[model samples]
Target: MKIKKAFRRVGMFSLFVAAFLVTITSISNVSFADVRDWVDYEPMRITNTVTNTVTESKFRQSSLEKKELNYLEQKKMYISSDEIEGPKTLEEAANINQYPKSQVVATGYTAGVESTGKSPGHPEYGITYSGVQVKRDLYSTIAADLDVYPIGTILFIPDYGYGVVADKGSAITGNKIDLFFNTVEDVYAQWGKKELDVHLIELGDGTLTEKELKQLNETDSLQVFRQQITES
Candidate 1:
């Protein structure tokens, strides 16, 4: 009976040990499955988070760059306006002319007159000597001394706006400019002599050389002017 009892106790102890081992193995398998799931899922979550952060950062940078570019453009426009103010004296005018033709500025008196479209009775009449038609519209015409402002030269007159050197006259000499009007009444009424600022935007073809032509071709103003002419 003593031996049998000892045997039964030993058997019970072995069973308990086996049950504990099985429980440990099951726990290990569950832990490994959980690790595998984390390995499979966590990298994608991390990659998505990083991608969103980079995209947001790029968007912010682009917005800031646009604002900076706009500010620079506004600043350039302001500076250009200040630079175009007319020079006061003949010496000043000469000095400005020494610079690039595109940058020349002249301040002078302007007189307006009507075109009769006749002959020897009116020396300044009808079609321009340069072959350009005489029109009273904006920037369409102006009578200037060819020696001073050649035909095809573009001028920006304050209050009067833009005009081209399309015609010439004996009395329209030096810094004096003659603005053409369609009717004598309109000339007498609104086209009185006045001191004005003039900005020489571009020199005429007669004044530019081949080298100068190459240079003028690269200018933004000339390009824009040509484009305007083409469009018109």
Candidate 2:
């Protein structure tokens, strides 16, 4: 009788564990692709499992029922857009920038052997250290020392656009950072290497989630941050 009761309890516990795991899987896999269909709407941001940026999209403002939208706008949840057209000089970058600006050695990287010491044919060739797939998207992917920059640091370069720290390079340490380029030639002829002042939009908490973004919205300049990235 005792053994039978024990078996039944164990079975129930196993079922509970399975259900929890399934629920977690579903939540982490949520994608924003469906949001592309929305028309006649306002801008909003969402979170991904890895690195996330405050991306703007057109959606029916009424969809939020005025809660999230109101909070976002009333609280001024975006960064400053004054960085658009980029700062012609470090002085200009620091002057118009809303965040704490600093200087760092910046270089361009490719997903090839010359930059990553990995062949292009490799399966993980373009994957960032933080598991983000590197792409030429609205914002650029940046590589730096994870110890120094964490995983989601956003740096706005003068005369350049915004770059998010999603990868790490073995040689990148201290205050040095690397910007991603689609091709090696672009790295050499275009970006190469230079020292520039960068504005620290927000320092990621070594984790990606909606919580971190919300925290930034509360205290940082997220309104202009969106315009700088999208418009510039």
Q: Return the TM-score for each candidate structure.
A: 0.38, 0.49
Model 1: CA > 4 A from native: 1-125, 207-232
Q: lDDT of each structure?
A: 0.54, 0.67
Candidate 1: what lDDT? 0.54
Worst 10 residues of 1 by lDDT: 103-112
Task: Give residue 213's lDDT in candidate 1 (0 to 100).
Answer: 28
Against the true structure, whose lDDT is highest? 2
CA deviation > 4 Å runs, candidate 2:
1-96, 208-232
Task: Please report how far candidate 1 places residue 111 from its true position, in Å.
Answer: 15
The model with the greatest TM-score is 2
Q: Can you write out model 1's per-residue Cα lDDT over 1-232, one digit (the tens) per residue?
A: 9999999999999999989866754654434344455455432222356556422224433433343211223544355755776644322333433333232222222232324336544554455666555654435467777887887787765544456777677667777787755556555566566765667777776432333323434555334344332222
